[model samples]
Target: MFHIKRAYEAYIDGFQEITMIIPKSNKHTVHSYFELIYEDNRKTKLPIVTRIEFERFIKYTVFTPEDLSLENKYEIEDEFGVRTDLQVGGVIRSNDFDEKYAYDGEDLGASYSNHSTQFKLWAPTASKVKLRIYQSHGDEEKFTEKLMERDGKGTWKVIIDQNCDGLVYNYLVCVNLIWREAVDPYAKAVTLNGKNGVVIDLSKGSHVSKVNSPLQSKYTDCIIYEASIRDFTSHPLSGVHKKGSFEGFHEKGTTYNELSTGLDYLCQLGVTHIELLPFFDFEGIEENNPFQSYNWGYNPLNFNAPEGSYSLKPEEPMTRITELKKLISVYHEHGLRIIMDVVYNHVYELQTSNFEKIVPGYYFRQDERGLPSNGTGVGNDFASERLMARRFILQSLKYWTEEYDIDGFRFDLMGILDTDTMNQIVTELTILKPEMIIFGEGWDLNTSLSPSSRKATINQSHQLSKIGFFNDKFRDGIKGSTFSVQEIGFIQGKLNHDYLSDLLLGSVGINNQVSLFQEPYQSINYVESHDNHTMWDRLKLSNGKDSEELLKKRHILGTSIALFSFGVPFIHSGQEFFRTKEGIENSYNSGDTVNSIDWARAERESSYINIVKEFIAIRKRFNCLRFSLKEEIVRHIKSVKVHQNIIGYRISGIEEIDRVKEIMVLFHNGLKDTTIDLGNEDNWEYVWDGTKHYVEKGIKAECNKLPIPLLSTVVLVKY
Candidate 1:
């Protein structure tokens, strides 16, 4: 009976062979041979069969079964009236199979030595492990040397006296009288993408020993700039050599300048953070070539390693790290914080991954039917609930913060992570860096994962306390071009009942207001980001007009509203010059053809840039505009009224006399001329208007009723 059970289980893949134990109590004769039948009606019987020893149980390895053929599918039946069906499937076999090759050893405390080297790897299943080191001068098999033996937990370590810097190495473990090869899990530097494990000397190449400079501040106050490294610098306008590489970020006359171009722009635009797209090592799924072309960097192969393609020199990994450090240093120098986009949701599904080669079932989430679930739109979604999976994510984040000097992280699709694990990580990260800006795409894409209780809402949705969310409501209301005039009228200072006010005042019609106040600073407010069309593009598509002046005014008004609104404001890069992607909203996988910002537009539309600059300066000048919601300083001045096309709102802080501090914003969307009644205010004076001609001093005197030209927005100060 045990032999039959083992043979039945052996049908599955990954089970190379099976051993069965038959009990002596079973009343069966040796002459009654085992008969097996497939689903196709094919039958076979064992010609030589014998009974086991007269013990309670017997164990022996069954003869290796024929490799499963596509035509083989059937049932099994024996003379003892035992019968079962054969189904093609796979399973992970553990007890008899030893997949591990290394062991966990004593804690080798942090080291800074140049000549000495330490190695560590985790292999819980191995009984004995040997470290094989190859001499640098010859074939690996010719000059082999055993360095050290593994410890009790299956970890092996060795520190050689010779300069073993660039040596190729592998672990050979003896399991059940068989020896197989395994790669060292903890190798800092690997060769041939881990096909042939090689040791690297950290002192060589561009590895820098000094601690990286601190970021400007925590990322809660940042305005993100999401860009692909390759697409950002490969164009002729980029003007850099290590084009699209990490070193290119330091190239004097390229997009790095444009990256910093928005520093003063953001400082004036009133933003505190800059969330960069994924900078981790990833393959280009766009062009299919792993070495070149544009990719969002989602297919992560190595968690600890940087993307080598982003380095000027592919042979040197240290150069990538050094260049990234310098980029972070420069952002820090300019008082701009950096938040990296992290994708630990899944890994590339190629042949060279640890998850694919060993213990595949342990890494990914399985469906109810016992198949891997591909919910993340990638090949598979990681099961964060598993102990090993949880440790991998946490360790990766810690390595980035401690090694790369990252200010914070924006998790991509954080909802896939288990609730308990997400909370644990939030707590750990907060403790590590109290002000770390942690946020994620809280909504899950899979219907099975997204329960009614788990769906994301702006302020009330997240399970983690310190982590903020990207408020999609604010994004939709202000810039979701599909909204009708009625909707716009409800939000843009019309329909005085204030529907937009509800969202603005921290209640976005969701549950659990308690979490809303826990950290409202966690919310990122913006009309546009890298994922969506530029606000300008949306406005043009909605209004059906190409009026440059009107476009400039609308741009200023949208940016001004975002800067002065409640939560931290984020501006997509190139928005200051009225950048347009020509109305392509979902350009995620598109090539450089559709996504690149036209730098020439800035020169042609200098007036638009000046308007944006002035609006930013205005936002910077007034504390009332940038005040936190806790201040409770906003008072609705009901004296101002709204007409068919003109709308006005008054905001006064604690101070009233300072011209630079007090602000009254009046906006006109009407096509025809209309007079706006200021309700007899005594000290109102014209401060700034969207029109380029308004910058001149005497222009205010020549206009009728502040002369708000068609589709113009104006800002005034109480003298």
Candidate 2:
């Protein structure tokens, strides 16, 4: 009489090595001989000669089962009275075994056509799988259930002869005799609140792909504006009929206080890219009262489907798809590229997610003791190293790019992902759309990956050659730390000449002998984004109850440095008008009071907005600001430290086709105004003075004795 504990078989060069974990309780009585029964009912006795003893169990390996096939369903019996059936997936985690051989199925979700619908699920360890179909999302009464058959690939599949369009479904999987119900991981659309996966024809035509955006030769040419779909138009004064909806984001010509609002305002701002924070299906926020709840859309529920809360009809599967497509088309038609801020790092709930429920422990990284890894600090980090996990991410990216015609992607917590996935994404997407802007927040997070593995962090940016990262060094060097309200940066009178020079050169290789990137385009220079306090609030808190005038000047100075810096420039939606969340550091889920843009405030701060708009025009007018190559940057740019509080730079080597031959930029962080002597004899035209700007013959170009206002940045051009 023999009993079995854990049995697995590994194949190497047509030879099978069966390993078994036998409990220490039966060690003395257990026999070294084992018998294997194949599907043909033929039994063969083998000797388990080698044994590695552990405190709780004994590991035994036998090399006699050389001709056993991986697909053969077999049984094992040992002399210690242990007996059990064998499974191919049981040995996938054995030491030195290739885990890549773990069985996977590509068509593991419902696939529908006009004539028939087929459903498949990859559950190697499960004894049974069933499909349940309902007429609609809410109609659960007397729904139909169909049995599925297991295939050679370990996938359970079924095909319904009739068309199953306009139906909602879920799977009833029986794992080890315990039944569990789950939604499809590859669902293209979901019902309200993500209750079930919906089946519908995705062939509905839209004009999203036909719209074109203004092209630039380099990634540095893009100036990104980040906004949330709900917060963008949730205010009552937003002047759009469909407030807090996708339609509102697409609405044009709306105004508040006689100033253009919504899409019209963005067009007026002259931004080249609009980065929307997480438009995917996210948890939380009741769809009934969308305005009552507010979120930055970081909690992702489904990677491929749009959020129902932002759609006109939350119940209909095709509603969100059509509306979001319309919104993208509208932005492209206005010559604006849309960048989606994707959050694939973690999920809202781990156990309930489709990825987890569909495949038990395959999608996430786990420790040796089988505990989930918390590298993202959000409980569970996705395991991009796994083949299926990598494939899922790559497939989702392709679907978005080809279906929606999106211009770019901003990955959230990108450092948690392995470098191989990021590089693979860039390689694949470039083939689809050349010159697409790709960047993200590559903060070094605690992850399971080793330090040398592919990471998208600032220190490891060279590994991801084409991807850009939000330059925290440039952010803190220009404005202040994102975490603290008391720490003041350069604009608040804490100037570091060496650091400023590095940031101005895009933090590229060796401008100040300390660089965070290999190329200028790899740095996204910004002082304010959606994650932290606005520049206005930072100055107010750190500068200590400062006067409004002084705060305004400091804010302008910070913006000037960011816009003028090398690499891509990113701005928050209302940063131009000094948007504030009432000193709240993390306003991700706060309601409209703290999250809305307050178009009224933007109206009052129109002067500052005008300055920012002018700065963008100036940045675009000069080719020196958008240099793409490292050699060009080193040769064309020069910086000098005039004083502890003053720094100046001269940018030359502009192409003959450019409007100006050379430009001088000066930054003064002192409390009082200062004048500097220009080394050159050529007359310098004052193109910008922080508060004012001139286009032609700006204030009579003077090479010597140039005055810069207190806490100001100036740009002078010379032909």
Candidate 3:
């Protein structure tokens, strides 16, 4: 049994340090022989010593006694000077040992041919740390165990020789006469529902190198499609063997491969990018499920490793990696980019987390009362201001980009990170991959924080000029039809329409001026994204009716306006097919029932799909529709006519001298059909009308007045 000789907190430069002592023993003793093992499978024997003194500061540490107490029992002294017992008595083992810090002069960190592995844990408060290696095949067998040696710092490391790669292991750490087992914070791999760590073959698969990727070309034209892996595949129409798995996306005959959901769908829809939801290792918290109590994958467990549930065969470690490469290749071949929606804001609150176990105070912010900050409302918020924490985030980004050939990243909650960190990341990422795209949810949840608390604060507004933001104002104005009084006057066909003109020219209203017009693609315009209510749901709320025909008309009008607006237009998945979430606004926690895109609706709602397809074609055909440059290319004829229920505007543009471009747009928001005058034009021609009428040259006589159906918009081109 280990006993603490002396225990007291010593403050150094606004940090606390904990020291511990353990008595040396003869047999099964603390000071006996031991070795250290690292990821490269290099080992070094521990030097025999009488006593070990472990000293560490709070900032850079990665281990906590509370996490280690899973196997061993321990005690903590409160502010009142009362000691409380903490439980411990499990096993702890390391999967990777940093050989560079070992006393042995060999570069053991670079070796990985043998089964031997090394583990390193930071336990500043532990009196002693021990390595427990269990027999691989035996039910209950004991093997050679050793007490970890402490260095100048409080790092505890041990090297052990194992029979094979799939052996179970744990760490036995002692704190205040209580011993417990703790899982390694840095374990690269773990067994499914098992206590021991599994050895992962990092080099077994073909790693995609960043140099070979063509991501540079497609990064600039990203139109991300955020989707869940399971929902995309589990649908009955998906038709793939590896359903709901990584391989399912690459499987032939699948919805994703049939050009129905993957590259084919994106290419046909003319979107340039696909941004997937969180794909990292996450816990599927069942209680939050909408249908059968399932998690939405927000509880991230590991940053570097992929989720096991998404893999077709978790034991075959390379399956997910290999399949992911195929998916990327398919998208790249079709001239489309892939972006990942990353969550570096906070991690799942697990006992074995790096934030909870090692350097807890350094990884997260603390309140005035010295409590963990919960800005994210998910138990804790990551302190991205910390250097080590920042490095970890950067490393994860680099690994995904360099290994998976991802074109860009869509940060989930970017405001959680400080401005300096974001700027540094942008600088480094741009230098590494010049065309890499970066954007995020710029709003910070914490209102109490300085500079970022205010809505569209001066500092935050300036940040938008540097990086792209989700243009919510533009979405609301176009979809909701509720803009400032100035905008209303313009849309109402009023004279001297400068305010409406500014909005029509792509102003998000936050800046009080037209900044987006300077670079149109910077404003990602959308009627609905994953966060907001679907366009149909919003319309239902406003209209208080569920008439399918009226909804279809509204959808057509919304799409036409969005595509014609001067910004990069984004359509949510299944919007073309008139997909609806049954009026559920916030379905982030909903299961497959609420989140799945109904492909059957596509066949039934063919008319809506056709309208969307036509609008997409029109947007692609005319560059001026989506043009952002501050140039008055289009000329307004200044001719307006108002019938009983219809309003019309006659606009024209000049291509060159002798070539005149003209179009007459009419909006009929009534129930009955009505005719409107086009202000005395002899050469006017009917080009497109929503009433299933397609116009051609010399088909109709010249008429200034045209009849339009109720609740429909008409566009007529004139020569």
Candidate 4:
């Protein structure tokens, strides 16, 4: 019923003999000679043509090369005398160009010198490329355009021997005679909202804080606190000098209700690393007045550049970079590490995105119908398996670690990425910093890539040995399903307490046939994260009839289990004080009021905060809480059959214990108090009890029977 209106393609196989392919659908329609027109107004007639079958709907007619030499303008006339501009479509595949014309240039983006600046772009198929440089901002009248030369490696390069420092620039790439402007993908600095790439000497950003991140030997040793920069100080009571900026994180002595806020508050809480939500240059927030807009920064605009919206001076790109460095520096000075939340799985826009604008259909994955793939639940999943895409990701990670000195990375929707790319990242990053923590949401998403191809899910966790996954099993097991509020977890009267034993052993063991991780370090155990409802809200929704006392008990019980687990423990910011999003489940764009931490509640509920602090101290004080190897876990840690609702475990063979030769961690989830029978009841001593309103010293046990109050986690030690 349909016929090809017009088709044009050029075959380039060393240029010795070039052919133009005009594919027609419904070949049953007439026939005629194909004409070729050159830029010099010369016409070449192709009297002879060969027909070939190309696709189901298309029939290709090939025309011999007309000996046209380096011509930019070309038009192909079909049998119906309809002339169309020739484009390089089926003439080449994205991967073919990637493999054949891979850019071997040592420097990417804008590499600068005192007298000259070289700009490079990897657009192998671009017919013609030009570099447009502006004299200054708000001055469109004065600018210069320079023609670029293409190398065999497919890189387009233009050198400006004059000083182009502080000048804004963009690339003008032509495809099928259609020109498109694109921001540099390798740009280290960009204008507000990524309008253009700025030519600034990166070396000028030399002034940096001397502070270093807190040292961590292993991933399990970290107690991570997840936070959003905007939400941290956007609260009206935050009292920070700079509200909703990287500078706000450095604000000292800022407090509410006589309690410390910002970095000072985190110090008091004693978390080793602060995993910040994405701060990379992302779309959505207007840079000029960023406080008016709030985002979690998952919509990545520029992977390597720091977000301008988070900087005090959004106009200056270096400030965004320098300010973020200073913020990390301040955290480092206070013995804290910063973990960057990276979103490389998908981009916000398709056509408008630089990945598309520069290389068209090359950067993204295509489905069976050749449409953009949406595995991340975001519109387009990045084709990380592609050569250039993988290279970009690897380079971006290195930039963040080396430039900003980030101690860790939290990849969002990491399962959308292929295992090969993830393993390569681990291999390279491990060499750079072996101690650097790398973890992410390894959720299995149905992507264009089949299950066996790319998924970095928990089932495939063995492949990525060094990387870790956010233990959704631990998350759901401890605080119920994040999806439904009515669904209760282990702490909230969910009967099957047997699964808690699996989690207590870090969700993996030699005996555990149904383990989620190959090693304990691969599991990032947590009850609440930035993605879903807070533990308080989940408990509130699930247990509506439960009193405030029971709700608080449930909250503490969840934290206790996660903290005691043999994995890298993670907590959402303000989770210690029963943080509530006012029942808003997904607060990604719910504005400041909906997402800001309630410091007043923190002060009122200081006891619960004290409970979290005490747990952190205990985890730090005892080597038993953090087992180094899987063999040690199996040999030393074992589950005890205390009760159906009680999850109990014992710690032995720990040489670092000064007072306790045997340690027992027991959790009582039942509505009534439960009695635990310690095998060595006579020698057992009650070292710590969660039922106490405040943290206190060890109290001597009665020795016959250990009575644990309902909804409380108790610890006992025997010397």
Candidate 5:
């Protein structure tokens, strides 16, 4: 076969260049001439040859008539028909091109019915498009190819006019002279390992949980708990039968030593939402042997399909979809919302990705040197600002919420996406689920996108009011720098009043000093998550010289502050039970040995788990702690200086807060005990004496004269 990599018009009104690899076997004579052949059987002769070598490929520069157009699909013939076709490479990437061919129809993917199934794809630059349908997912030889007619406005479609349910298929789009085979980006169901798209009738009903998620009117009411499929159930003692699969996670009544584990344990923890790490069709872990490998699912392969490995029967495409919906129903049954961790920042393999294969240069952002941008520290940055790309993301988000009833979204590397796109996402998703919780990591990475304001980084928080961002300020303030293990914070023995103040106010700007966020609801207070070191491991690393007992106190104190602080609280899966990864900071690809949640530790540290549960209770009890607006916080909260190392904040009365009039939260960060006298004040009860709750049997004001414990947190209330 003759290899013609690409042909591009580098400069207008000049000769075009064709890049190819000519080995010694296919060496041409000096008199060898070239001609262009169109699909319509027209021909044009070429008289010039220019050669430049690159690695193994050679660039042959030649000229055709200025009047001749290269926009049509054609082939390069040596004389008449013994030739190769050149792929188009010089399609300009710009907003103008996207607008010209953007398809606004909702029927982009396979629309299935009992009688007819219509398939549509959006590929504007393609010369021809074909559909390849396989009778079975694994049968490589048994398939049929059908041509697709270009229906106006960049969409190619074909109506089977017969039932195609359960049949596997892929698109063979002949764009730029190369016939690229790719699964439909809009495919709702896919075959094992996501090799091909499966046609299924979504109109039919499937099994789901009967119970619904609790009403969460305010966004601040969310208490997010992050976990992964394998990490949650892969442990040998996890008491799950289908370990590391969706069925395993769905199985309830599981426990170790009678203490709840797996799905049951999540409900017992009292978190409002469970944010699962990417469970979509990712590019890691063998579906046949999921236990042999471990991946956090950050490497996205297909944007809209659920991962097959998590299903009980990955070989069957419908099984994956059915099981995933059942898992979501379980979360709903427990009054917990499910948030899917979506990775739209980059793809797993740029060159071989479905987006690149369907339309090479349209889905990615390129730099001035004509190379892909690597802002995500990955190979390429997904250009979400583009019209078509943005539409795809919005469509995908709608599919998950409407199809699976997912209650929220935790965007990964959200900074790589555009601000306008993020704003549109919340507007669209909330329309389906009004109480949807949308949050993401907003770190400003060094991506190639220009005019930084357009990117959805934290710096552009003002433009995004309804969306929430992971408050790194709160994270570093409580657990110290995630990068510098030895660095200390307020709860880590070192105190920065400014950092404490910023975090306590949910990173909302205070006293004319604009902070990381404009509203408290926009700040997601979290000290530990899937990324970086768990708070337990960080404590051990930072205070390694200290005894294990003291380290536990530090961990509890940091977690307590994050829980009670003003924004939505987030917890790692096994954080309450002192989850440790053997000090592995970045465990994205580390095997199950380094990533699995140790239920054995959950049994050992159940006391700390109780403390976390109580903290979540206290946060949910007080409306002042979960204020959504900046005005509510500015009007009701004020800083109090009681002692040298003790940081205290007071919350005045709010009508929404019932049974509690005024609240005072005190944190003692010193090395020694100190007396925090109440000045003989009456009715100043201790609701929480550092570690214990006293809502029924109040600890009187006399308890205030008692010396405060070193590195402890307490709540005082006057009812």
Candidate 6:
């Protein structure tokens, strides 16, 4: 009969008000009288402030001199004794509410001890809270229900005298007078399919030793190779027993036709870090029949728990943790670090998400009309600016870094988040691991967050200098637009020397031009990643009339630019062998058929793969390519006045950071051969001429002129 539109503290100090709507169907003659019933049944009469008649309902405002606690639910009664539960409306999204109920205690989730376990849940607006403990995660009936006492900052707490290890639990929160069950938002471990939270003994596999990763002096020195645990080993020819699982991903001695296929292949390929797609607990796959469906794990269901489908024993909570740890350990031992692709920009769905269930309106952003913001395109942008929301993200990242020994985090749709959150993430994660790599998709998206300048998009990259952004400019400038296959890039003969030169110089400002980054490492140079079509596939579409031989070289040219650019180089899992997705663009749920990494392609494209390896070696060998500061890049790197079809640069101070005195790079973007002027003294040598690479095997060129291979990247090193 009545809807409580708002019951919040007015901006004027020491004043409180309530707004309610009474439908015309409730033909009560006297609708002005009302009383606010507190939780203890104490009734306080409210004075009528204003009323406005509408077509179908009458809007009424009641004023109270006293400020009531929003944490304690109240009820409102009309003159006819029709009572309605006081519901949270626009107030929960206000700054006053966030400051009052923001919980800072680290014990928001179940904290286990040898003899006792304490559980805490942040449900400030709930009328009642109950803890449901189940013997098993999937049990329909709970073993027992216990009432929890309200703690400081609107959190509910309860202590169990016995150990809670292996026990499954969830909270039943009574909000808006309706009981709803939800998993703990801070759950570190979950049962199969993330149905319930598990009290995990974190010390079970804590004995895993530190991995012997390679020495990377700077973040730009990292050669990132992105892969998914499922796709990396899902191919039928992948020589491993545990297909598409954590154990299989790191399985040693895996090969096809006596060639390395899985982890071994990555090791030999010279990549420093392996960026895995979200391996955290996500939706879209049945844990019981994991092989029946496929997902890239972007739909985050649990922040701290590993994905169940990737574990061999999904039913065992500890199995996932230990197995994933072992996987990281294996890579670390092989001199490769790991970076997790985290999707904190949004949840899989807002309505069914634990954040909405616990604190309905606190976790996500809302538009002026009070609807969920869809900046993420999947509904609901995470409210990282909120204190409690930021706390949750910070804690989750720390847990992964400390517990799983995670080296870095790659944020998904980072633009939807606030700048403060991204800065804090980089600062804290760097403390835990100084050699950490942090970057994300900083695409400027339309979101409800005010002051567009505060978004962590590339537009605000100067504010977030420590974090890197995926260089869309590099992708589009070198390989064409990722979204369109018909558009050709500089490598495909759509040469724009000045534009391509900016990208080759790491997209940082040069020659008074506004650039994308303040520092060189802030640009993540790559043409292919997990999100778009492979470089081979795109070149095939854009240059449809070109031959396969020329297409392969064009693909190599783009990869070459990305690797040798003045930024962190990134490579997709199957980019080397002309890997195609059969024209599929968004393969988030494309199953194993189109997404799996075909090992056979490795054998066919071994030659191209070797060239990429040499490019990596050159990048690692030269410090000029991995300049940490903007001043170093601006001073050392100079654009060469080469032909219009070629992109060229000279690093003069190479003797300072490397054994070589200087180096010159030429990217020929035309279809015809050309001559590049070399010194007549015969002091330069061919470090890479498309056919061979490496300084030790460099051939001396005793001439003043050098022939540039068409659609090829050439490097000349001075000794």
Name the best candidate (by lDDT).
6
lDDT of each: 0.54, 0.79, 0.54, 0.79, 0.80, 0.84
- For each candidate in turn, the TM-score is 0.71, 0.90, 0.69, 0.91, 0.90, 0.95
lDDT of 5 by residue, 1-719 (tens): 12444322222122244433344334552324577666787878775477665564444555666433334566676643356665555433655466567787889989998999999998877778899999787887899999998887788999998888887999998765568899998898888788898898765436554457788998888889889998899889899888999999878899989789998888888889989999999888788878777888998988888897888788877778878888888789778889999998899989888888887788998888879998988899999988889999999999899888989999999999999999999999999989998989898987878899988987888998888999887888788899887677787777766557667877877645568888888988888998899988888888888888788888888888878788788888888878899988899989888898899899988888888888888888777777788888888888766787877688886645756677888888887777777675667677677754434447665645746778888887877
State the displacement of the C-alpha of residue 98, model 5, in Å, after optimal TM-score superposition.
Answer: 1.1
Candidate 4, 238-311: lDDT as tens digits:
87879889999889989887888888999999899999998989999998988777788889898888898889
RMSD of each: 9.8, 4.0, 11.0, 4.1, 4.3, 2.9
TM-score between candidate 2 and the true structure: 0.90
How many residue pairs clash in all the candidates, one count each?
A: 17, 10, 39, 0, 1, 0
> Residue 568 deviation, candidate 1, in Å?
1.7
Better of 3 and 6 by TM-score: 6
| Model 6: CA > 4 A from native | 1-15, 28-34, 39-58, 71-73, 79-82, 679-681, 692-698
Locate the minimum summed-lDDT window of 10 residues in model 3: 89-98
Q: List the residue pairs that clash in candidate 4.
A: none
- Quote the lDDT for 428 in model 5: 95
Ranking by TM-score: 6, 4, 5, 2, 1, 3
Alpha carbon deviation, residue 378, candidate 3 (Å): 1.6
Q: Is candidate 1 or candidate 5 better by lDDT?
A: 5
Per-residue accuracy of model 6 over 217-253 as CA lDDT, tens digit each:
7888888999999999989998978998999999989
Point out the higher-scoring one by lDDT: 3 or 4. 4
Q: What is the lDDT of residue 652 in candidate 2?
A: 82
